[model samples]
Target: MDQTNDTAETLTPQTVRHSILWRVIFYFATASIALSIVVSAALVVWNYEQQTEAFRERLEDIRVGYSESLGSSLWFYDEIQIQSQVKGIMNLEAISYVRVTDNLNINIEVGTRPHHSDIETLPIEFNGKPIGVLEIAFDRDAVIAKASRAAISTMIAQLVSLLLLASMLGVVVHTLINRRISEMAAQVNDRLSSNQYSPLAISTGKDKDEIDLLIQAFNALSEQMIDQLEQKTQAQQQLKTINLELEDRVKERTHNLQKTVDELNQTLAELHATQGKLIEAEKLSSLGGMVAGIAHEINTPLGLCITIHSYINDNYQVMKRAFDGGGMRKQDFVDFMGMMDESLGILDKNLQRAAHLIKSFKQVSEDQTGEHIRRFSLHDYLHEIMETLSPKFKQTQHKVEIDCSENLWMETFAGSISQVVTNLVMNSLVHAFEHTKEGLIRIQAAEEKGNIVIRYTDNGCGLSAEAKHKIFEPFYTTKRGQGGTGLGMHLVYNIVHQRLKGEIQVEEADQGAAFRMVIPKITEESNVQ
Candidate 1:
């Protein structure tokens, strides 16, 4: 019998113990009951306080009414009116007693005075002067009785409503939440006790409650765990096989990477060399254009000189032949001399102009190519630059003006400075005054606060907002298809900011674009490559 009892106890499935649903239901019931009780008590207390406040407000109204009436009665010295006012205050439910006294030693009392300590005194005033004193006492018993009745009624109603709410809630919880949770817990326990990896067999209805969602999640987790275990076993077998070739694969990849790095280094070096050559080629191309312009400019003066010389030679020959033939009179001789003198003067002027042009061209060309630091007068240097660039503007109506201080000098990279100024002037001619017939470029330089400020302004079509923003960026041009290289302003920026250690900015202009460059004047020793 003892063995049979033990077997039966074991077969009971350990009582399938899971009381979380009951415990949760009980917890909710306890919380609901506690909340209801607290709310009921609070309502009762609030209602009581509100009733007491209403009683006090009633007493205040009676006191004020009596005071006003007594003030008029006492001022008129009417005893009957004063007594009538006191009796009216005593008629108030909360007013237990009313007393009135005056400066004339008159005293009046009404109603049964209360033993409560709550009392208020008011002085009747007539034209800002106290005429009498009115004392009013409130009946605490009546106020308490009314407040208690309201509180008791509220408590009873709250209790009944709370009881009905708790009962409904308990029924809903037990039927909808607790029972479903208990069934889920029993299925989970059975699965756990049997060490079964299969999903929960609990079926769900169309409503799909929380318990159904929990079962779905548990089933998905079970499937995922089974898949992971199989994957782990396969991964272990694959890992052993991969370890055999990992070292060799690593060596092969490292070798390939090293080869790729070597090729990259070679390509990088080639690119660097190519960049240097390109920059040099660009410089040479600029110089070639400058030389062609100078040559064209020099041809005009040289040709003029040759023409004058030929005319003077012909005039001399004719005068000589006339004299040799003995047909030269004094008048002829004087006219011939005068003509000779005029021809000589013209010849000299053309030759001198040609010489000056050649000199200016030489100086500018040397300064652009020398790459040397030199102390030079800024005013004279600017004039030389303008003169060298004169041929470019000679055909056009555009004019170049320089306004540099006479004493302003700098010991800096003249070659870079020459290139910068060349770029600026050329940029203006190409972009700034593209459609304009008449334009003006003003270049001004001054020394201020130990820095040279050079302002360049052009009275051509002012830069658009977009053009101004991207003007100094390389290879960015509005006239790209028109053979614009777009490197002019970029080179200028580099020379001014990088080579000369300067800063440049574009200033706002009304009808043109203005650029201001600030470069520090340093000694030759301080100038570095």
Candidate 2:
């Protein structure tokens, strides 16, 4: 039982052939051998029939011999003689024995009740007419006796022939079908042994027979497996590449964002630093211009003082020595006192000039730093600021004109207002004065619609349409690098709008530019909610 179990368990593909291949080869070969055996047996039986017919013809000849015998022919009643005559005529050697029979029951035979052991009738004809029946028993007993022996020998030969044919058939069948299987097996084994499976080239047979069908199926299976494996591998590789690319792109975008943030921060710092520099620059520029103007204003007065002092000194010394000598009379004394009065008058006149200079300087200084917001004369503020900016106006031949309503009470930032005025005047003198030799700056302050409207316009170099549009944005300037900070108008805009709490506007003039500040008068407090 265990051995049976082991035999059953031992069957595997490696150990045995595929059932389909085996079944096809088995059925094909079985059909071929079975058909051959059937045809051979049919031929043997057909030959046996022909041999049996030959035996009947020989029996007919024996019957004809019996009929033609002289004694047996007409009214022959001697049975023994008839039989002897029949035997004498057919005196051929292979006859084992002979017998005769009459129409009556009287018959005699040399053999016995069963001489031949197998007897049968043969037709007897005379002149094409059935006369009687002739029973010629060919010596089947002796034939059987010999045939049994021959049959045994023939069977042995046939068995040998069948064995030889079967051996050859089995060899041919195995070579045709089984050999193909072995070849396919080798291919399968080779595919397994070698590691190269991708785009595996599976081999197949040209014939579409049973064995070739199996190989075709196996080749197809192998090719399919290779295709699926390659597709899966390519998908995995593509997935890996996509993931790597996504990671790289994310990192690159993050780095770029960080860099952008750093750049923006740096730009803010630069803007703040630039603002500081601009403030200091405007201050220093204003101070230098103020010094130049003050010095110019003082020059004439100081020159006059120096001349008066020298005149008094010269006259006082000469008159003092003459009066001390006493060679002069009372009239000489009167003349001396008169000269002293003239010298004192000259000193007094020069002293008045110096006093006027000091007063104007004081007023301008006070206006520059004044923080108090009050109702002051618009005309007075314009004159003081313009006179303080005289040196710059002198540098560029710009004439500043003041047109005032003579009484406009506008409450606003005074220091910033002065600064705005100073910047505007300088902008005209410096930036707008391309035609400086013929430049004219007009400042007009009037009460219009319950508001104080101040228009500062210049006729020197007109602003282009494009330049007028962005004049107030910081760092936007038409002048490229000639000390044009572009912050002047921006500062003016901020002060006019926020510090003074007023509306300011600008427009392109035919010759230069015009700036307007429309400030609400103190009286317009009721107009605001």
Residue lDDT tens for model 1, 259-372: 999999999999878755655666777778888888898888788878877887887788889889998789987987898788778878877887887898888788778867
TM-score of each: 0.53, 0.47
**Per-candidate local distance difference test:** 0.78, 0.66
lDDT of 1 at 495: 77
Residue-by-residue lDDT tens digits, candidate 2, 188-282: 54545454343224344466677667666666777898898889999999999999999999999999999999999999999889886886576
Q: Candidate 2: which stretches are off by over 4 Å?
A: 1-248, 327-357, 366-375, 393-398, 473-484, 520-529
Candidate with top TM-score is 1
The C-alpha stretches of model 1 lying farther than 4 A from their native spots are 1-257, 462-470
Worst 10 residues of 1 by lDDT: 5-14
The Cα error of candidate 1 at residue 340, in Å, is: 1.9
Candidate 1: what lDDT? 0.78
Candidate 1 residue pairs in clash (backbone atoms < 3 Å): none
